[model samples]
Target: MTEPRTFTLRDDLKLALELADAADAISRARFTALDLVVTTKPDRTPVTDADQAVERAIRTVLAEQRPGDGILGEEFGTAGSTSRQWIIDPIDGTAGFMRGIPIWATLIALAVDGVPVVGVVSAPALGKRWWASAGAGAWSSDERTPNASPTRLAVSGVDTLAEASISYGSLQQWDQAGHLDEIVSLSRQVWRTRAYGDMWSYMLLAEGHLDMAGEFDLQPYDMAALAPIVQEAGGVFTSIDGKPGPWHGSALATNGLLHDATLAVLNPA
Candidate 1:
């Protein structure tokens, strides 16, 4: 058996971006065609054919380019080595995608030994892409300004919850989690609140447009890509309970200044 070749973080990030390009080609085409076949999953969430196709495209590229790497994708289950895994949400907001909403994106992340080191969130419909590798600053490019250089990203300096603008997924999600009251209290404390939802909220937080974002009932693929971008942008990302990484099934991303304060509000001990 051939040994797996190790890659630098930048090299892996480049490959991730290429994978995003592959995903975008399929996702964007399907989004425009509007020939979607949606079905309810066991969990009662909708999944579209485009989601499967985008993931399959990414997996095919990984099979040829990084055969030894593992994959944990939304459409297909896990495969290969856990030590170096590519976590993907081929279409992070399938509900939005199915409804022709342009908030969806393809999320790709390379996590080494459970720590995400590189991430790419490509939203072709939104005409934007964001990426970062650990130690390299977060960056984004706009399709509207294709000729311009990628701009670096940073989180806001809003230090107090009274001054912080917070975004979340949905009121229903939090209510279902029995935390609706907490989120309501949080809304009262924050300067502003919006249900930007999906991957856009975290990307906005990373860009310093928002101070904080949190949501419940997330899979690793849903968060793996966003975490690195937020962290590289001088923010912090953790489970709502304050545990690090994407394994915790929920997410709370902030400007680092308000993580503890927000955590106290959401998961008070």
Candidate 2:
């Protein structure tokens, strides 16, 4: 019997980067031409259109390139096999994108049997892209400096909450989750706190600019692309309760040294 062919981490990472490129092309154009004059009542038309368009573009490419792989996308939901799936959030911060904020990004991740092994986050509006695969260190590049080499990312060395800088996505989310008191308590212990919000906070944590980040009410599409990058950058990515993987409905990312301490604070009996 012949053995099944296997793909390398680098190969998957390259495909993920290509997927991000296609996604950025569609998302950036829509965001640039967004009609801010239209009703601002959180109408889903613009973002929903962009989201579906980007996902379709990515799915087309994947269908041709990796016919055997499964896909889980925000706009389209799940398809194909669950063993080796691609999780996608065509635009990670739709509200920000719709509002002409440049913090939105396309998130792509490859999960084999539910564990993400590769991740790519492309924020074209911000002129930045970050990516990683297992064993390969997390890295980022700036379109503003086209010729510059990609920089390897690393989380900070801060080991204590008292010295760490942290970000939580929103006070309202915490309050709604009934964890507002814990968040407030954590902020008091941290050296600094900000509600940078969305995927940017976790990206900042991976880049070592922030020591920790956590949030409630997240989906796998919102977090799968981030887990590998944070993990490869020498950080910890888990639920606020400390369970591994993006299956949990919430997230807590920190410099590895502070994960346990932060989890304790958020989950005290």
State each model's CA lDDT, in order: 0.94, 0.91
Write the residue-wise lDDT of candidate 1 on 48-109 in tens digits.
Answer: 88999999999999999998899999988899875899999999998888888999999999
TM-score of each: 0.97, 0.94
Q: In model 2, how large is the Cα lDDT of residue 158?
A: 90
Off by over 4 Å in 1: 1-3
Instruction: Estimate the lDDT of model 2.
Output: 0.91
Can you write out model 2's per-residue Cα lDDT over 1-269, one digit (the tens) per residue? Answer: 97655778888999999999899888878885745333222424344577778999999999988888999998778999748999999988888887788999999999998999999999999999999999999999999999999999999999898999999999999999999999999999999999898889999999999999999989999999999999999999999999999999999999999998999899998
Candidate 1 backbone collisions, by pair: none
